[model samples]
Target: MDKEVIGPGACVLRGFVDDPAEMVRAIADIAASAPFRHLSTPSGAPMRIAMTNCGRVGWVNVRSGYGYAEVDPLTGHSWPSMPAIFTRLATHAAAEAGFADYTPDVCLINRYTVGSSLHMHKDRNGFLKDMPVVSVSLGLPATFRFGGQGNGEPPRSIPLVNGDVVVWGGPSRMNYHGVLPLEAGVHPLTGNTRFNLTFRAGVVKPAPRLGSKTG
Candidate 1:
């Protein structure tokens, strides 16, 4: 993955996916197992885009609050593990961004339509401060808002195309970021919806075993 420094502690790697078709197909199959659903914020506000999870820890929100859980609340089962392809991509992207040996345990799959957009926010999953968030964009085009910590200054609008990967870590790990409303367009592969897979390394907490007897 050839890296292009976009900002201080931010980088973009182009054409990271050798076979975008295979990646798309893999995602579709994974989604069939774990369907996408729009998640609600802790404030009870519904998110714009529908999302799914394919990893050890799936990000979820409910009346309780926002955080990562080992089990999928919708299914009462553990979220799907990250595919080998996704792991490879995550490692390569992180390396390009100067983050060595990154193995993300959480994979957040987000789906977006023409009018779908994400509000600017930082990821606070309680991981190492230097672990980068590797985001892979496929399907439709959208403008990504990249800003400094806090909401003081205006963010730079970065155009993301299909097969592009963005990695943020180090001083920029907590930087605020989000996506603009997706533009109406059809990709030969994804057809209509835009697919974004964000890879994040989350702390692992052992879950209780089923049918275990306690003294």
Candidate 2:
């Protein structure tokens, strides 16, 4: 895998995952149990992307606020376990980006279709901000903005295609970032949708075994 650095402690690894089809099946099995839903923001506005999660903790935007929880609020059950492939891929990517011993306990899976997007923002939710975030991209391509720590700085737009993984930490962990509106098109793997799996290093909560069924 070729590691390309874009900023301080932020880099991209090309074609990091050897088999995306297997990962897709794994993700489908997970979504079959937990399912994916459009989440509302803290202010009651619905987000553009549909999401679900697998791992010790899942990121959620609930009626109360945005946070992580051991259970999925929608179904009253625990999130699926972080697939071994996911953990292995994330750890390898982080290590290639200079972070070792990355024990990711939260893997948030976000799905985006045409017109889906996100505004620039800093990630302040992960428990271990000191650790790097390992993000895996699959399916459709999208433009990613890597910005400065402050809001006023202009962001650099980078095209991210399938099988690309990014690692961000250190001085760049708090840097502003977001995705541009997705273009209307279909990728062979996922049709018109894009998938982003972000892994954050949080304390483990003993995730359920892989392929466990939930209502």
Candidate 3:
């Protein structure tokens, strides 16, 4: 795998996964346990991307706000456990990006089709700030926007394809980033869709102040 530093605390490892098919199969199993759904935003609008979670805690957005939960509100059951392979891949990628002893406790899986995209945003839901985020891309391709910590300036666009892994932390931890709208395409392995796995380490803190955000 070729690793390139994209920012102070971020790097992308091109063709990191030798066998993406195996990962795809594993994802199928995970989805069977915790089905993907369009989670609602705080504003009550459905998210554009389909999402599910695996591991001890999963990212969630509800009327209450953004946070992590052990149980899927849709099913009232714990999210599927993080597969061993998933943990290893995330750790290895993080370590390669200069984050040592990285242990992520949650994996957020996002599914996107043509026209699906994530808006530029900071990953600041959890109490832990600046935790390293390891993202693996599979199936299709998309443009990634990497921006400065502040939102005023425009972002740099990068293309992410299957088997590519990107790790962000350190000085780039709080930098804004997002995926641009996907174009229509098909991949031999994933076909008509793209799957992105983002791993994060989080610890639930006390409820926020009245004016602060809540999950």
Task: State the lDDT at 115 in candidate 3.
Answer: 98
lDDT of 2: 0.84
Q: Show where candidate 2 strays beyond 4 Å.
A: 203-215
- Scanning candidate 2 in windows of ten residues, the lowest lDDT window is 206-215
Question: Model 3, range 93-164, lDDT digits (tens) per residue?
Answer: 988888888888889999999999999998877646657999999999999998898957678899999999
Q: Spell out the clash pairs found in candidate 3.
A: 65-215, 66-215, 67-215
Candidate 2, residues 81-149, lDDT tens digits: the string is 989999999999998999988888888899999999988988776476789988889999999988998
- Name the TM-score of candidate 2: 0.91
Indicate whether candidate 1 or candidate 2 has the larger TM-score.
2
Candidate 1 residue-wise lDDT, 3-59, digit = tens: 777677788887777777878887888778777877776555677798888887777
Cα-based TM-score, every candidate:
0.90, 0.91, 0.92
Model 1 vs. true fold: TM: 0.90
